[model samples]
Target: MVAILGCCDSTNPVRRDGGLPGSVPAPSPGALRAEDQLPRQRRSLTSEDRSAIAVGVTCGCSYAQIGAMIGRDKSVVCREVTRNRGPDGSYWAPVAHRAAHERRRRPKPVKLAANPGLCRRIEVAMDEGWSPGLIAAMLRHEHPGTSAAARMGRVSHETIYQALYVQTRGNLRADLHRQLSLKRSARKSRGSTGRGGSHTYDHALTISQRPAQVADRAVPGHWEGDLILGRGNRSAIGTLVERSTRFVILLHLPGRRHDAPSVAQAMITEMSKLPAHLRRSITWDRGSELADYVDIQLNLQAPVYFCDPHSPWQRGSNENTNRLLRFWFEKGTDLSTHTPDDLARIAATLNARPRPTLDLKTPTQALHELLANPPAA
Candidate 1:
């Protein structure tokens, strides 16, 4: 018998019995092979590959060995095993494969749907007039763990928003969107085009002269104040947000008495209830309602600072709080209808809502901590 070596006809070089000496034997012409069915360039793992991986894992083969058996990179094998493993830390081929399919399916179940506990928490927060971002942050803040449900609870802010705005994404309550600060059925472009009327506060201290500490919000007492006007600008509510804690205090400027004296007195009465340390500085826009800022400074003993004309962003915390207050006190409504007690309740509700800026702590909690510790001047 002649031995064939490296000839085109005997490229695979088999023994007399027809088995390749040092390599896998060629499949029979009519026989199907596992590798033959796999696409030449597969984007994802196939059932056959998963089956091979399962067998390899059961036999204690290394990831590289398993990948070699399945014609995939070692990292690919590693990721597949790591991600699709069962809860008990076992990698079952069938379960993993099913999970992979579920993941690949378009419009997979909404996280908030499968997780009712998470949905309830989200709904409660939304109902409390919390922003989606705030609710998301608070969820993450409270559930800082690696458990399955904890992981589910850590949905992104955009996810909570989609649950509210996108009809099909989550199991959140239908009316929960109305509980949002904006109370809008759909999102709108976020911007403000209304310009503040130019006013000269010749004797007022501009935000430029404000201390560096106030701008950075390092010390706990600095505040930002503004008036959210009602119908025809006849009635208004004064809003004060602590720059550090975002703690809100709503002034009941009832009977359309949002004049300079009324606003100043309302602010003084509400803010004076705090310890002097918690009443450090006040920053305001150039609104005429705050014309008697001097009286506020004298009574509260906190110097009032003014933002530059037409620059609402300068008092960002206050601007944001005003927008939130609008949820309870809508524009074009009679502000006087909400009495002092009503205003107090609304303010309490707002201060109780968690703020994203305050590390998911409610402004009330942050303020309490500040009061308890009382940061130095």
Candidate 2:
């Protein structure tokens, strides 16, 4: 067959391109000259090399022959074939590439772990329930003078966070994740709210009715509030965060259905406990649960303002706090199981924790400072 095709029966034939069929094209003279000036190859495997490997293995070709065709060392070819192939010896190109990529990507040790003093600093902040962003901000606030060594020791919050969540290579202890507000086995982004739009209630004061001071966040007592629904919408927990201090208040609804009347009574019971000054106003989404806003307003004396349809960001602080609540009250679980005392404890913990928006002060401290010296309202 080879003779009929006008080619010698050499076991491996290099085409005019200087490579076997499906191999990388031959380098031009210009390419050869440029190679000397370019950086060395990372020795990483390429897709073409993997294709050659699959073909060579199918033809029972030796490692040396495959390596020559792909311009890789024989040892590299052998390792690639042995490491990436399935138990039945199949060399899928996509599988090979994924295996090689996973192997080549070796994680580096965390910077905080290398410097004991810096590690201790990070550990202390975490112990005090400081978020990674807060810790980083505090570091930036502290870094001063022209000390090169001190500056080099500081690391970003992302580095500290990767040390906690990524697979292996974390110098931090597993228990360290406890200090994080959203502790999970793996990190996941906050995604859609999954709540469908329902213009169920009418006669509402829109967020536009809200004072300009709420947007500026200069005035204390104005709070953003929302209900975080639990499993199958059968349970819920109310969240309230003051605009200025980010102080949190959680409402534990022991009842099953969080309908308007039930939620209104819960809001009244929770808000009435607050000092009259701290109960300025409550901003919430237009979910049917808050339909009894008039009742809540009459009882707590804190008028309720509804966000525009499908506009959660109007109550940004409450939305963010609800995400944090997912750390304790995981989605698709019964939230009513938690007692009011449990809710209070969680709220207190959140309140005592430092906030970057609050100038790295705990919400408790910021609220205390604001109340101690009220702004000229």
Give the best candidate by TM-score. 1
- Model 2 lDDT per residue over 1-377, tens place: 01101112345464444446555664553554474535435577777768667766665667766665455667888988887778687888778998777766756445656776776777888999898898887787777543566576566788788878875544676778878875655676534444424554456788998999889987788999888888788888888899888989887777676877887888888778777778888898877788778888889887888887778888889888888778788977988899988998999988988989877899999878766765542
Model 2: pairs clashing at backbone N, Cα or C within 3 Å: none
lDDT of 1 by residue, 1-377 (tens): 11111112344333432233564543332333355644435678877778667755654557865554455677998999999887677888788889899888986777887888888887777777787888778888988987876887679888888887888888888788777655678876434424334454788898999999887888888989888887877788888888888888888886788888898888888898999988889998887778788888888999999887677889988887888787788877888788889988999998888877778889889878877786444
Candidate with top lDDT is 1
Instruction: Please give the range of 10 consecutive residues that has the lowest summed lDDT in model 1.
Output: 1-10
The lDDT of each candidate is: 0.77, 0.75
Superposed Cα deviation of residue 105, candidate 2 (Å): 35
| Candidate 1 global lDDT | 0.77
- Report how far off residue 18 is in candidate 1 (Å): 78
For each of the candidates, the C-alpha root-mean-square deviation to the true structure, in angstroms, is: 12.8, 14.5
Model 2, backbone clash pairs (residues 3+ apart or across chains), number: 0
Q: After superposition, how far is residue 81 of candidate 1 from its true place, in Å?
A: 50
